[model samples]
Structure formats: C-alpha cells, structure tokens
Target: MKFFTAVAFLTASVSAFTTMTPNKVASSNAMAFSQFSQQSALMAAKQVPHGGVLVNQMTDDKDAAIAKATVEIQASERQLCDVELIMNGGFSPLTGFMDEAAYNSVVENMALEDGTIFGLPVVYDTDDESLQPGTTILLKQGDLPIATVELTDKYVPNKVLECKQCYGTSELEHPGTLMVATERGKYYMGGKVTGLNTPVRDFPCKTPAEVREELPDDKDVVAFQCRNPVHRAHYELFTRALDDPLIGEGGIVLVHPTCGPTQADDIPGTTRYKTYEVLKEETANPRVVWEYLPYSMHMAGPREAIQHMIIRKNFGCTHFIIGRDMAGSKSSITGEDYYGAYDAQDIAKANAEKLGVTPVPSLNLVFTEEEGYTTADEAKEKGLSIQKLSGTKFRKMLRGGEDIPEWFAFKSVVKVLRENI
Candidate 1:
C-alpha cells in the first residue's frame, strides 16, 4: 500500500497557541449547571483513558516494523474518522475499536469494564464472515491503509436493545436509530488497532497532543463545539461566556467544529471550515481559538453530550460549552425531536463533576436593533427591540439569493455558502 510520507512533518505546521485564565466556578443558581470546585488540579499533560496511557499505534517511524500477512478490509467514512482519532490520540485511551467486553459494557451500561464512564460502544461492524476471532486485518479507506486491527472477538449485537439503550428510542425515523438498524452490519469486530497512517483530509486536523503543545499548562481552555457555521448570535454567546463570573478573566474560547460527516442537509465541512477561517481573520479575536475535530456525529443527544465531554477532556479542555439539545437529532419521518431541549445539559451537568471538566451552558443570545446583541433575558429585561431569523428562513434566503442581513451572519461566510451552493 502507498504510504503518506509526510506524516512526520504534520506537527511542524501547527500554529502557535495562546492560553486563557481558568473559569470561575458556576454559581449555585446557575441554570442547568453545577458549581465547579477542582477535585484535583488539571493534569499537567492531557488525559488518557482509564489506564492513563495514550494508545498510539502508528508506525510512522519504521517501515520494517510493519505488520505482515495482514488481511485488508475496506472502511466506511465513520470508521475512517475513528481511525484518524485513534491514531492521533484524539480518542486517547482507546487503543482501537472496543472488544466484546468493552462493547457490551458500554452498550448495556454507560461504563467500561473498570466502571469508567464511556457513552458509546465504539465497535467495528462487518458482514464478512471471513473476519473471525484471531484474524488480523488491515483497515483501509479505499487505497490508503490506515490501521491494522487484530480481531479478538466477533459478536452480533442486540440492535433493538442498543437503539433503546443508547439512543433512547427504537423508532426508525430517528437518524441514530435508523443508523443502528440499517447502516451497521449484523456483526461487530473488536480488537487492538495499530495505526499505519492518517487519511488525507481537505482541511487541517491537528491531533490532541499537537493542540496540547500549543496550550499553556496553567490556563483553562473552554471549548465551543459546533456542527454549523457561526453567526452573530453564536459569536455573542461564546464571547459573553468568557465574561461570565463563571469564566474568569483571560479565559479563551476555542471554536472547535466537527469537520466530519453530519446530517445530510447540514452545511458541508469544507464550507464551514472556510467560514471559520474568514471569521477568525476578520474579527481577530485573540481570546478566541480555532480548531477542527474529525468526528462523525451520531446525533445521540444526551449520551452524545457526555461522549463529547469525555472527548474534550482528552483534548485538554477545562470546560465545554453545552447548548440546548446538544447533539440532538430528529426523526426524519415524523419531524419530531427525539431528545428534550435540555437533555444534554442535564446529563452533562450530572457527569461533569466526575469527568473533571466543567460544563459551560450557552446562553440564548439574540440580536437587538439598539443593543446590537444580548442574551434573550437581557433583551427582555431592558425591553430592547429584538430581531430574529429562523434557520429555515435563513436557508430559504440563501437558496433564493435573497438578502441575509449583516447582523445575522458574516458576508464572507454567506459568500462562501453561496458559492458552494
């Protein structure tokens, strides 16, 4: 297989990083949040899974050390995202796909064998009966060999149970439920993965360790997660988070967007990346940082929020911004949301204390003709004239070549979206 020779140079390209002050503890009355008290100081280094060791399986340094007699298997897009995260230590602590024991534990209960919290069962599924226990397979995305997995177990998961347990519903209309029912194979393969290379991506994807190198050891990093382009309300919401008594002075906000596959109708990753780049350059908010995650959105709502918290903690974030209906998905057939609006915040808040990361709830910011932008509550308290734009209406305007007010979104972002469409 042809290898990516430039793997060694990936780290050199990362830009310089800045640090922000630690977040203030959430007040007792903070909505949908718990007061933060450091149980332990933030780790001097980034966190690893249960064993406190990063499972880096990449063999980029030595060609002769490569595994021989490997059985090649094609990987799907989601699996490819898993590979990149695993190899780059973005999914630190996970050496590879979950084995049967781990998978069963995660599925049945949101914990590992050792009772560590893990939201989803990261298993490798396949219909090929040829891949059995004790077989070693080279997982690939087309021609690129990304990792080698030594399969130790193969089992048929109870899809019905999984759909109910993990996603909270068995309805075929729910995207996650539908994925579990149809897209996934009948059997799952689990084992240790030895990374060969990271698949080439159109956008820059830095690993956890690389991002950690840029961050300061003593500073707190608040990460803002998004799957869509940022607009005026989003900008106001996150920037205001830093000013909250909960977030101490000098705290920085990391605009970390998922750049992998999302809902079929959502904006493309490349276009979103362009929008972020232009916004960062145009605004020049030194307190804000930019990064991208190669995560495949499961739209599992609350469980997915916990999953995101764990992932962000591994990425060296001290806090994560959790908005209403985080990672929430809807039923395509029924047009109804599967999870409650505050489900993610409630769940994440319940577990954030144990996860060692604080959950910063995003405020519902609105644009006002007089005040520019403010939280909805503040706007109402002051009786400011509020201006609103529905997402459906915004998309309609985009598709119709109608005017998108400057207050709603950046012109550069709109231009990119227009050009892409």
Candidate 2:
C-alpha cells in the first residue's frame, strides 16, 4: 500500500516537468553547459566492476530455498539494507556475509583475504549462542522471507578494534562507534547467501546490471553520493562536475543518494526519498540520472569514501565526486571534528588510479547575490555578496513555515519536506 501511495504521488509530481515549455527546457540545458565547450569532446570508457565480477545471489527457485532453511531469524533494518545491496550486486564481490577470516582481514587491513581493497567488513551478527555452524538460517524482514544463508563459520569479533580501525575512534560519542559498541550483536556469522525476494521499500533501488544497461557505454558516469536532500548548492556542484577536466567529455552525472539508515538525528529515508523524487521530476535533466542506494551510512570518513567509490564502480561509474569531509562525523560530547576537511579527498585521490575510478574534488561553491553560485575563492576575489544560511536557521525557518530563499534550496524540495515533516 505504501509503494502504491508513493507511486501516485510521483505520478502527480512528474506532471510539473511536463508543464514546462520546450523553450524553457532548451534554455535550462543551454545554461547548464554554457561554460563547458570542451565537454562534448571528452570520452571516458566505463570501468569494470570490482573483483572483475558483479555478484548476484538471488535464487530462481524460491520454494527450494524456503525448504533449505532450518531456522528463521528476523533481520534488523541495517541487515535488511545490506541484504538488498548484496542481492542486487550493489555490494559486488560479496556473495554472502563475510566469514571470520574475511572479517578479521578487513578489520586489520582495509582489504579482503586476497588483498582486494574493501572499505569495511560486511558480516551478519547475532547474540544467539545456540546457533551452530552448517545450519541454514532464513533471513526475514518481518514475516517476509528475503534471503537464506548457509552458515559456514561463526566467531566473536573484537568491537573495540573494529571501531578503532574502521572508524578511527573508540568513543561512544561517535555514532558509528556507538552502533558497533551497543547496536551490533556479540557474534559475527559468515556464509553464502541465496536471496529469495527483495524487500519492499519506499524507494526502489535498481540492480547494478539494470543501472549499467541505462548508462552510456562510451561516456563516463560521474557518481555523486549524498545522505541528505539535494539543496541548490549541491545541485550546482554535481551538474558542474561534468565539466571537470578529470571527467571524460560528454559524461553524465549519476545523482545517487543513499536512502537507508543514517544518523539517528538525520531525516528519515522515506522523507528524503520524497524530496529526491520531486526534485528529479522538476529538474527533468537528460544528462542526469537519478537513483537511490540502499546503503547504511558508517560515517567512516576516508575509508567510507573509498567504499563508496568501489560501490559506484560496480554500478559502471568511471569517476566519483569526492566532496569535503565526506562521510565525516563528529564527537557528540566535545563537538570536535573527527577527520580533516580534505582527508576524504586526499585519500580518494591517492587511491583513484589503482581503483580505476577517477576522483573529482567538489568545488567549494558559495552562493553570491551578484553572480549566483561561484567558487568561494572567486567570490572573495570579486568581493561579491555571499549569501549564508546555517542548518539550524534553515530548520527553524522550515518549522515556522517561513519562506526559504530560493537561492539556497529548491522550492519543490522544500515543499515536499514541509508537507512530509
């Protein structure tokens, strides 16, 4: 019922784009490309998926899988998200949950047992000591069976070490560290998964193969990752990235947003999905492709950035937009930043060549009353009047129903948020 409800809303919202005249659409496209004369001449070939293969564990025989399961375990929200990704090849090279060996290797080194680069370990955790090896367990979301894992190994993981190595902190103030410390179970289980069905979500995530089919084969696909709604500056950042020299000519930008569990205080995925759906219809840009990713945020800063690049690469992306302090978090108690502003960009740049995915550093663009959006450096040089809006102020305005500046946020996105929130 929720799926159908969202479909109806999307249908009505999409009519907004149809209302725009042909001339307006042409003008919009022309304005977006005014500064990129050389973009038409650049060409970037698509990169191969990580591990030279995309893993799909979905089984054709659902009844057989149900019969194979000896026990049923309800999956948590995070586990459900992970199952969707692993089943869809979004987490390729991972046929199932990581075994003890793979988990230890990933924790000690940001690589699998074969030394393949991996951002973080993916394992199924449980507190049940009664579960034994070789047991086939059915993973379910509520009453719906989604996947089954043939248990091969189980071991207690070192949570403190995982927090220190993966997130660079053992402090509970950090959301990631807190999740590992308190939310995750005591034991980690690894086994190959056979997916039976995909979860029903507000946003339908496309499979890697499905996305690749729609991508242009000869042109580069620049992936933009975000965990929040796309505001005006965010829109400008990704659209303008197509003109970056590192991106191949005639590249299309993939506005891929993670629509899964994020920080406890962040906006809900269903709400964020509505904002993106409306924005996509309103923009109607052919050069931009919109897709939702079912990835739970780790907020692991540099390591998370690498993880994003590898995942995007599996989606046939040839370049990724690495912005300032990507996936960075702060200490709740001290309000101290965990990673440097350029830490993600630096690490992404360093590993770009090896990953076969080029990293495009996001421009530090600021809003100016005189010339619209421009680099912060250029705005300073020209002495332009910069417009400022803090997150706290924006939330207050939204709650009060005050008019948000069109220059700071898209009117359509704001309307969706207001109605939903």
Candidate 3:
C-alpha cells in the first residue's frame, strides 16, 4: 500500500502550492499560519486555497496583498548568526532542515544571499517601501511564516475577491480593478476616510507588541511618518521636526513608508525597504522607529499630500514630514499644474483637527556643495546657488543613464534607483 501510494504521489504532479482541483485527500496535517496573521490566511484560503491555480491575474480568486521586505538583523551584528532559509507565501519555520554539513555545502557553492534554500516566503516587489505586507519569512528547521501581507480587498465569507478599492475622493472616478486583499490594508478609502481602519488589517498588525512593551518609557511619543525614502531632504525635515519643542519630546522619529501603489519612475519598494534597512543599520539616531505603513498610493498629487497628513495623524503620528509636492502629479495639458504643491501645509493648517496631526512642511531642496538643506534664505547667505532637479529632469537623467552626483543624491541611493527604477 505504501509503495502504491508513493507511486501515485510521484506520478501525479500534485501542486506544492494551492489545491485548486476537486481531489479530496483528507489529510489532518495542514500547514499552519502564525497566530498573529493566521485568521486572515484561513479566511483567504477558504476562497482561493493554498497554491490554488490562478485562472487569471486580473480577477483571480486570490488574496491580493501589498508587501515589503527588510533585512532585519543588524549588518554589524556578530558576523550574523546561522542565517535562516526563508520560504515564500507564509512565515513558516522549516524544521529538521538539512544538516549543517549540507547547509555548509550549499553556502560554499553559492553566494550567501543567493542561497537556494527558500526558508522564507518572499515576493520580489520592488514597489514596496519598507517591506510591508504580502511576504512570508521562514526560519530554518521550522515552519515558513508569511509576514504581515495585507489585503487590499474586503473579505466576505466564501468569496475573497469581492471588494472595491477606495476612490481617492468623490467627484473623482474610481479606477479600480477587482481584487482580494489581505491584512494591513483597506479596500475603500485606503484608510483615508476611516483613518487606518482597524477592520482593514487581517492580523493584530500592532507594533510587534514586544516593541511597544520595550519602548522607552517616554512621557510622549512624537512619531514621524515617512511616506518616502530617507532622502537628504527628508533627513533635514526630520531634523527640523526633531528640533521642534512641540514635537521634541522623547524625540521619536518613526519612518513609516507606504506599503501600496506609487507612480511610475518612482523608486521601487524594495529599494525603499533597503534604504530604511541601511538607515536603521547605520544611523546614529536611537530615537528613530521604523514601521511599515500599508496605505496604497493614489498618485492624486496634492490631494494625496493632504491624505497622507490626515492618515498619518490617524496612525498616531504626532507630526508628518510634508515635503514639496508631497504626492505631486502633472496636469494633462502643457505638463503644467502640479497637484497640491502647497496642499500639505494648506491641509494641515486648515484641517488639523480633521486631519488629526501637525504638518512639518519643507520646500523642495537641492544639495549645495556648501549648504546642506538650504532654502532661498540660506542659499543667499551661504553664497551657495541651489540647483534643484525637477521630477521630470530626475526621471530623464535616470533613463539616460546619467550619473547622479552627491550634489543631487547619495551614491548609494542613486545606485538603488538606477537598478530598481
């Protein structure tokens, strides 16, 4: 019987992923999801099943999630402990994995990063800022665990793909494609209207409970929500915010990158994730906190800037970094008319209670050989002429494969854009 069963299993190309067919093999041993994000998977699995065949990417009955990836261990930390091989899909710990001898063989043969053992569930979406949801991490000799992969759809019993993405605002047509979302996101308003609606998250999606517990017992937590990567301009804004008396308490700077959609020619998500990873790995600021914000981008430009401020406020961000053209867009005609270039300041000033936070607005900055984060005043005083690059110019330079000097961007960040963008 055992031989016959083995033969059947080998002959049949049983999918290692989802069970889409009507083959009912009642096996009691099913892989489990983490306690934190398990219920969401269960609910989604009911609709799509594991490794279920994708009939169509457009309307497939699958759990649609936005994900981000960040290498957690410190780079300088002890020559790295035994690294785990992560699998893609869920955060399951792979147990009884190959022996150390076998592991050494694999490591010796391939680059440590290119190791073939997929102990974690990883998806390569360069679009995710800080490795938000929709990814799974695995531990060697344990079950593979999918991280906080969030859903952009509403999950109804039986039909997971039955939901609508939020239209940025009324009077604006909704450009939605049908989708099934997971935890760490919302379908409607993308948490803009409801304010990071708790219902949007599939798991607890809290601050890792332990992180919250381990947080310094400060009298106040002044969080800085970053929708973009850590650019020099961003650093300057953060420094300014950190220096502010109203927001200087505990001097907490939380870098929360958007976990959803961004415009074309924008820095890919993985690069953003790597940017934060390096920052966390290298920055001298112990007060900086990093969290993944799972809100999708609308590319609505000025309205997006306002929305960012409001949403950050909802997420307990005491203040937000409102950079020039927070989410700028170009008008259809003459390539003119940017959306809400001043929308950040205007919204925060006029609708503080409605938005629920303070907006630290900063103008577009250019690096000067002399002055670091200079404005028109500093430019004149320091005798440093500021040569700012427009979004169009930057994109063109990238496409033309031109080198971005330190005067324009950090070499490391520029390398990320050149490769990922």
Candidate 4:
C-alpha cells in the first residue's frame, strides 16, 4: 500500500550526494530524501535566507525520501507535483523532525501540507511574508497591518462601520491611522489604511477583502485590542466594558490580538489565540468575537496605542479596552523606549472625539478586593487581588518557564501559556 506523508523535504541539491565527481551528472545523481535533508541542512545555514540552491549544492546526487513529490517553492508559487522531497537533514528529540537552526531557516522558504508559513531567504532588510498568489496582503509597508480596519469607519475616517447610535454627525474615522512620531517628512498617513483581523485557522493567513465584507454585521459589538498577551488586567478591562452600565448591551467582544512577528518572550500569536479560544469557551461571554490581528508590532507603544483605538472603530466597535503602554511597552519610558504606561489612555482621552470610539482608560477603573473594575474609587481605596501584569514581564516568565500568577492572569489563561511556553 502506498502512503502519502507531507514532510518538509528538499526538491534538489548541489554537488555532495554523488560518489561521482561534484560536477559529474550520473545515472543515480539524485539520492534519497533522507540524504538530501541531512546534507541540505548544512548548506542552508551558511546562507541568510536559506534556499534550494544550498540544498541542490549539497552533493551531485538527489536522494530525497520520496522522489518527485509535490513542493511549493518559497517566495514564488512555483508548485511541483508528484516528486519525492527530503526532510531537513537534521533532527532532535527535544524539538522534533529537524534542527532548529536549519529547519527554521529552510521552513521559512518551504511550507508543508499544513499551513505553516515562514519568512524567506531575503536580505535582512527585505524580510516579509512569503509572497505567493494566495498570500494575505495584510501589510504593504514597514509594520502596519490589516487589523487596523475600523469596525465603524463610515463616520470616522475611512471607517467601514458607521456608528448607528452615535449622537453627533456619523463621522467617518480614518482606518488604521495612528499618530506615530510625525516629523513632517519622516512619516504621514497616506490616506491608505488596512484592518487587523480576518478569518483564518492558522498564523500568516492571507486577508481577503471579499471575506472581510462577509463578517456578519454586529448591531452590538465589543472590540478587544490586544497588543500584549491576555492578562487579568485585560480581562478586568473588557469585562467592565462589556458589563458597563451605560454601554453594556448585546455587543460582541472581538478577541483581536496582533499576530504579526512580535518579539520573543511575548506570547506567540498562535499560543495567544488559543488561550483566547479557551477563555472564550470557558466563559459564556456571548458578546465576544475572536480573530487574530494581522499586523506586526511597531513597538511604538503610545502612537500605536492610538492606532489600535482607531482600528477598533473601523471594526464597528463602540468601545475599546486600552491597556498600559499599549503599543511600545518593550523598553523603558525615559530611555527613548516603551510608551509610558498611561500614554495609550492619555492619547485616547485626548482624541476620543477626534477618533470617535469610546476609549476605556485604566484610571476610570477602580480595582477592588471584591470586584475588578468597581466604581468604588470615590468612596475608599481597596486592595486588589490581581497584581498589575506586564507583557514584558510576562514574556520573561514565559521564557523562564515560571508560573504566571492566577491573580495577575486568569487561571485559564495561565494554563494555556504554561503548556505553550
């Protein structure tokens, strides 16, 4: 019986597999897939964006496990059908089928039957999503993503969803327009904008404008802007927003987390999304909607903070949950680094009218022992169980394999992170 296994193997190799001279082309010039996988791994590492040339150059023989297997060439959509392909030559028990260094390098250029996408062998500066015919066009420049699309853009600038209940002129909000350090010619909103969410089962999925239009219109929606991993504070903020006495209704809370290539220690997009899924399932938060943000991190905490707010508006959200250092929380505040903890809220507080969505500043929430966001700040100070959690700090814990406190993070969110960390 013939079986089909779609392992990430190489298509060809250079001059190392053949007993015949390096340049000599013999009858069995091609070796087995295993041979190519092992040898090709070596050649792949030397080059920056590993490619087939490194594999083919391994030896004169082509020895993939299966000969003439179907392969999807990286960068371009040159698909080969019915050919044997070799796996990455190296493997490890701890990791799995391939060497982390070589496997990672090669996978970026190759995709298996599964939908795992990797970066390409381009020069460092030219790195981007694997460009293919069906690739999602989430980004066109530096770091902006399609997730910035507005839930309500008709009245705001370039917004797709109009505020049906908005009291003032239904303003069209700008889609994905964040005021990042503007020094005149350095950068400016080109009037072009993109959204941050789309339907997909995996990371790096392509954004379809047609598919986006198909999202069921939510007369009532709750937008969740996730720049960092999900923590107790995030939960506290959103639950409060959804349960707002004035704003609470039948709104759907969108589980929108940015999925673009974020820094290490920061939760991987897939892990974060899965955590959100578990949270969604555990809670009967009927109004919650879930989708990964397709944009990459700019590390511009404050400015990107405003951008997140504006994007939520395009998504048809009437309110957004703002976290500390929303955009640039990686570095320190005074060292020309992370956005100030309150910058995101500050920006939102100043621009709610100009941008249009109701921003939830952390200050408004009065954390208490009994309830998370209580309006008790006016009466008396209360001790909160949940210690303020930080994404940067969370990542350190993730990398360290330390347990995140249930108080800082929901018990469920912590469980998911522990498994994936």
lDDT of 2 by residue, 6-32 (tens): 232222211111121111110122232
Which sections of candidate 4 miss by over 4 Å?
Answer: 1-220, 245-248, 330-337, 363-405
lDDT order of candidates, top first: 2, 1, 3, 4
- TM-score, per-candidate, Cα-based: 0.87, 0.89, 0.48, 0.46
Q: Model 4 — TM-score against the truth?
A: 0.46
TM-score of 3: 0.48
Q: Model 3 RMSD to the real structure?
A: 18.5
Q: What is the C-alpha RMSD of each candidate to the true structure, in Å?
A: 11.9, 14.3, 18.5, 20.9
Global lDDT scores for all candidate models: 0.73, 0.81, 0.37, 0.37
Q: Is candidate 1 or candidate 4 better by lDDT?
A: 1
Candidate 1 global TM-score: 0.87
**Best candidate according to TM-score:** 2
Q: Write the per-residue lDDT of candidate 3 for residues 1-421, one digit (tens) a residue.
A: 2343223322332121211221111111132122123332222211221222111111121123112222321211000111111111111221112222222222233111223222111111111233322223211112222222121111111111111112222221222111111211221100000001121222123322222333443433444555456766666666666766666565576666764445444565556766666666655677777766544555544444554553333233556666665555443335553444676467556655444456666544556767566666677777896767766787788789887655555566666667776
Which candidate model has the greater TM-score, 2 or 4? Answer: 2
Better of 2 and 4 by lDDT: 2
Output the better candidate (1/3) by lDDT.
1
lDDT (C-alpha) at residue 214 in model 3: 33
Worst 10 residues of 4 by lDDT: 76-85
